[model samples]
Target: MKTFFSLLQKKLFAENAPLVMLVGLCPLLIASKTLISGLVMAAAISSVLIFSCVVISLVRKLIPDNVRLVAYMIIIATLVSVAEIMIRAYLPTHYVNLGIYIPIIASAGIVFAQADNVASKNGIVVSVIDGTLTAITFSIVIITVSFLRELLGSGTILSHRMIEEEYGMSFALSGGGGLVILGMLAAVVKKINSIKKSKKEGE
Candidate 1:
């Protein structure tokens, strides 16, 4: 139980999917142009990841070792299809905004990596917890990036237009700008972790 909690903590913070592992960045950089778009993508990915992990874990033993990769892809694709349909039906605008990125989740490395590394070898409960925590970590990073990008680039939060004039930098809204910001944020996180590690060593 202690080990399980420790692993959960690491997934949530120390080894965050987006910030640390840097998985799922393609959709993150594109769909993160706006706060709402980012949230939609995050939610879609989270739902797919959680459900897929649960299903995969439940059937891990039945799957053959040689065909496991192919099997994982099929399972992920099926779940992605379900998520895409639901999104299209309920959130047409977001569905369109997300575009190809929604379908791309079917092949996302983050989902597959989790399935291969943790879910396949773990109990159903552990797999579910890992999936949920990893999704939450990814969502947090993407949402934070989206919030900053939208605020700095569009001078608005959730399209409310906070600033009187378009004072925000235009470049900040671009895809290239998103990469720069993400890199800087990652560096900051790394620095903070280093500092904590050093302090612990001193103590």
Candidate 2:
């Protein structure tokens, strides 16, 4: 139990999904123009992550070591398809806004990477916790970036329109916002590395 909590903290906040591990950049960049979009994307990714982790962990013993990559991809792609269909049916607007990007999320390096690196080596319980933490961390970073972009680019908070019209600038939703998000991602990675270094020094 304590180990589970430790791994969760590492994956969620300490390591982070997008920031630390640099996974799932597709929706992170394209769908993050607004907080709503980012949050929705996060939910989709997290669902996929948790479900895939559970499935993979349960069947790990049956999977041949050499062909694990293929096994993992097949599982992830299936889950992503399920997510895509559900999203299209339940949230047509968000589905269209996200478009092809949602499906491609299965192709995101993070999912396969986690499956290969962590899930393959660990037991089901640890794998589930890791996957959930990674997904949550990813959601937080992308949501934070999207929130900033929406506010600065459109002077609106989740379309609530916070900034005065005069202060409103047009660059928020533009390609510039994407670049800013990337920069923020880099900064986050740097911070994590710094913390890791400090911890090493203390040890």
Candidate 3:
């Protein structure tokens, strides 16, 4: 249990998916205009990633070594399709907002890469943990950007209207999306460098 928690923390924070691995940037950038949207997309994508990884891991042995990539893609697509259906039935609003991006999760290179590189070779328990960690990492980065951008650009958080109604900017489609992503990327990189320097000093 201690080792599991340690691995989880490292994957979720020290080696975050979006900030460190830099995966799932498309929906991350697009849905970050509002904290609500970013959170919704993150949840959806994370669920898909976890499910896909589990399914792929289960079938890994059956897949021929040479055709493993194709097998993984098919499994990912199937899981993403199921995710879309479940989300549409239960979270209609999020389903609509996420739109085409939800399906794009199937095509996300991160999904296939994780399956092919880590999950396939690992046991079920480890694969599931890795998937959950990767998903959390992806969510943290995108949601952090969304939080900052929504607060700074529109003075709102999670669409709760933190700033005065008259004072806040409109939640238009393209508002601060690119700028927020760039700023977050820069900030994350700087933070990583600072951490490395601190580690070296400690050493």
Clash number by candidate, in order: 0, 1, 0
Q: Which candidate is the best by TM-score?
A: 1
For residues 1-203, write the lDDT of model 3, one tens digit per residue: 89878777677656666666666667777777778878877887788788877787788788889987787888888888888898899889977887898888887767876887788999888888888888877787777777877786687777677777566545333545555565557576768767966997999
Off by over 4 Å in 1: 1-9
Clashing residue pairs in candidate 3 are: none
How accurate locally, in lDDT, is each candidate?
A: 0.89, 0.83, 0.76
For every candidate structure, what is the RMSD over all alpha carbons to the true structure, in angstroms?
A: 1.9, 2.4, 2.8
- Give the range of the ten consecutive residues with the poorest summed lDDT in model 2: 12-21
TM-scores of the candidates are 0.93, 0.87, 0.83
Candidate with top lDDT is 1
| Tens-digit per-residue lDDT, 11-104, candidate 2 | 6656666666666776788888889989988899889988888898889999988998888999999999999999999999998888899998
TM-score of candidate 2 to 2 decimals: 0.87
| Backbone steric clashes in candidate 3, count | 0
Query: lDDT: which is higher, 2 or 3?
Result: 2
The sequence of per-residue lDDT tens digits that candidate 1 reaches over residues 1-203 is 89877776677657878778878888889888899999998999899889988999999999999999999999999999999999999999988877888899988888998999999999999899889888888898899999999988989998899875559888988999999999988987788778878997999
